[model samples]
Target: MLKYIRPYLLWTLLSPAFMLLEVFMDLLQPQLMSRIIDVGVKNSDTAYIVRTCIIMGLVALTGVVGGVGNMIFSTKASYGFAKDLRSDVYRKIQSFSFANIDNFKTGSLVTRTTNDITQIQNAFSTCIRMLIRSPFLFIGGIVMVCTISWDLALVVICAIPVLALFVWFLLTKGRPLFMGMQQKMDRVNTVMQENLAGIRVIKAFGRSDFEKQKFKTANDDLCNASLKAMRMMSLSFPAINLIMNVTMILMYTFGGKMVFNGALKPGQIMAFSNYVMQILFSLTMSSFMLMFLSRAGVSVKRVNEVLNTQPDVSDGTNRDAQVTQGMVEFKDVSFRYPNSGGDPVLRHISFTAAPGETVAILGATGSGKSTLVNLIPRLYDVSEGEILVDGINVKEYELNALRGGIGVALQESVLFTGTIDENLHWGDDSASDAVIKEAAEIAQAAPFVSRLTDGYETALGQRGVNLSGGQKQRLCIARALVKHPRILILDDSTSAVDLSTEAKIQTGLREVFGDMTVFIIAQRISSVMDADRILLLDNGEIIDTGTHNELKQRCAIYREIVSSQLGEEALKA
Candidate 1:
């Protein structure tokens, strides 16, 4: 926070400087009025009254100019600080590894970036505008009143300790509630995001009522927490006002007697009352500033949590090691999810995929098939062993260089809202339109794409909602193909396409990408039947390794899968 403030230090300092000028002008006006009443009106001196009026008018104009300057500088400093902080936070999040993202849920991160940052921004603006002005006004008012009459000033001094204690108590109690309110806000955002993303599922399953109830619960929790925090802060105003009113009554009662005794003038009593009001008003503003500070403190802590987190995966220094062959090997590799405190997802796994070879992995769900291939691209680091690409340890290669050589299409195909051409450009930004069309044709997506009115220029909805599951998968595959990476990993990416179309895609890929190493994870036996080798994974270990025929004869798990998908006669054949 201080680092960001350092850049705008001039604006920050100027705001308070001008604010002090405005407050000084404000303090002088009451004294001028007292002199006009006590000296000029009483003595019937028209020239004295006229001269003081002109001076007062000039002072008022100066105060107005000071106020405008204060507002301009404060706005610039606070808004600039927020912009810098938001950019730094977003950049930090972009650098986070999958493990770091898992630690902070998507909804929570969104809340911190948007709502939390906004809260802090508002508080900073208020601090610059009011935090400085109020304290100065309060102290200045006290000094002015004391000079007028020390006897009456003692009344304000007596009320100060009591009001200060009460305000302190309320602020202490409200801080924890404000913290809880922020957490509740995160819950509400999480529920809202989940509801929107899965609205189709909720409607399809006829569970709208269930989702509504869940949202209501989260929304109510936030409402209650917010009300509690606000309610605690509300007590500050009435308490301060009551003390202020009582002090004023005491001042009038004591000073009226002094005036009757000819010891104090009536005009001086009026000015003393006005100065007391200024002190109370400044104290009231300070109390409200404290409330804003408490909430902003919570937001500051949340933002720092993300900014301070160091990414678990850092880029390696060896940028010169290029992955030319696409040969990947895992040597006694083992991995478990961060903080899972359970068995490894892949246990002492080892395999080698030579360049240009097509290897298929077959497994039941949760068999760590995707995890095994994920290691190749260094999406995650292995817990116990080293993974090598092109005969160099993956950790030794720079992250961009390592990942750039491999193209991955995950099981859940995701697409952003953009033109089909733009989405494909993500794979190879320099690719020509002809190359993109050819990649789409190779993925068996040309037929449907050509039927659309706009063809490749068609716009997609969020997550490509306008397209069918099979269409989305084909587009993702086409995007990967456009990269023409040396290593391609398709993790059940073709599951949504029909068997015939899947076969066409496989054939096209093998024909066009024959020189690229391919790792295909699939449940369908037919998908891997023609592969150069098949790996049968059960649990976290590879149970068998061979061609389709060899696995059918040697592995019972493979035989069972074949018999289930095809008939018993077909397996016997």
Candidate 2:
């Protein structure tokens, strides 16, 4: 947090400097008013009164200048700090591995980046202005009040401890509630995001009532948490005012007698009252600033948790290793999610994929086929054994150099809101028009894309909602193809496409990228029927490995799957 302030040091310093000027001007005005009342009016000197009034006006103008300058510089410093902090937080999140992301969850990270950072920024802005001004005014007022009448200053002195103690009590009680409030806000945001993103599903299934209830529950929790925190803070204002009023009453009671005895003049007693109010006002401002700081303490810890976290995955020792040939091998690889603390999701998986060969993995819904392919790109590191790419251990290659050579179209077809051409550029930003169209054609996306009024320049809705499922999937495949990667992994990428279109895509892939290593994870037997080799996975282990024909001849599970999907007559053939 201090490091973010370093860049804006000039503005941070200037804000408080101007605040000091303003406080000084404020302190001067009370004395000038005392002189006008005691000397000018007492002697009936109109000239002195006019002169003092003009001087007070000039002092007010100076204070205004100071306040404006303070606002400008403080805003600059605080906003600049927030910008840098948010950028660094976002960058850190981008570097996180799958395991790291799973730990934080998407909704919680979003809240920390937005609401949490904003809380700290506002606290910083207030500190440079009010925090700097309050203490100076409080001490300055006390000194001036003492000079006017030492006896009256004693009233202010007594009230200070009571106010200080009450503020401390409220702050101490409020800290944990504020932390809990922030967590509840995260829950509300998570529910809202899920509702918006899955609105189509909710509507299609007629579950809108259920989703509404879910959001209401989260919203009510946030409201209750916020009310608890605010209720504690609200006790401060009335208690502070009561103490202030009582002290003022005591001041006038004692000072009036001093005036009657000629120990202090009436004009001096008036100045004394003004200084007492100033002192109490400063305390009130300080109380509010302390509250802000207390809440900010919680925000600071939440933000630092992200910054100080060492990513589960870091850069490898061999930072310069790049893949020349797509040769991937898994040597008895096994993995389980770090946070799950259960059996390995993938167990004893061993396979070798050579350049120019196509290997397919077939499995049940939870057979870990996708997990096996994911390790090749190091999305999640294997808990046991090793994975090698081009004969070099994957853990020894720089993450960027290793991932850059492989193009993956995941099981989920995610598309951004942009022109089709821009989305394709995500794979290879420098790819030319011809290369993009070629890739689109190979993925069987070009014909539908061409039918659009703007062709490849058609603008899409958020997450490509304007397109059909098959259309989005084909575009994802084309985006991966645009990379012209040495290796390609399509994890159920063509599930939404028709069988004929899927066949054409498979044919086009072989024609254009014959030498690229391809791994296909599919449930449909026909999808892998022509592959060079197929591995049938059951649970977390491979039950059979062979070409389609060999598996049909020797493996009972493979024969059952073939009979179910392709028919018993087709299997006999």
Q: Using lDDT as the measure, which candidate wins?
A: 2
Model 1 error, position 560 (Å): 1.2
Clashes per model (N, Cα, C within 3 A)? 0, 0
Q: What TM value does model 1 have?
A: 0.97
Residue pairs with clashing backbones, model 1: none
Scored by CA lDDT, what does every candidate get?
A: 0.90, 0.93
Cα lDDT of model 1 by residue, 351-415, tens digit: 89899989999999999999899888877778999998999999888888988889999888999
In candidate 2, where is summed lDDT lowest over 10 consecutive residues?
A: 312-321
Query: In model 2, which regions exceed 4 Å deviation?
Result: none
**Model 1 off-target regions past 4 Å?**
none
Superposed by TM-score, candidate 2 places the C-alpha of residue 461 at a distance from the truth, in angstroms, of 1.1
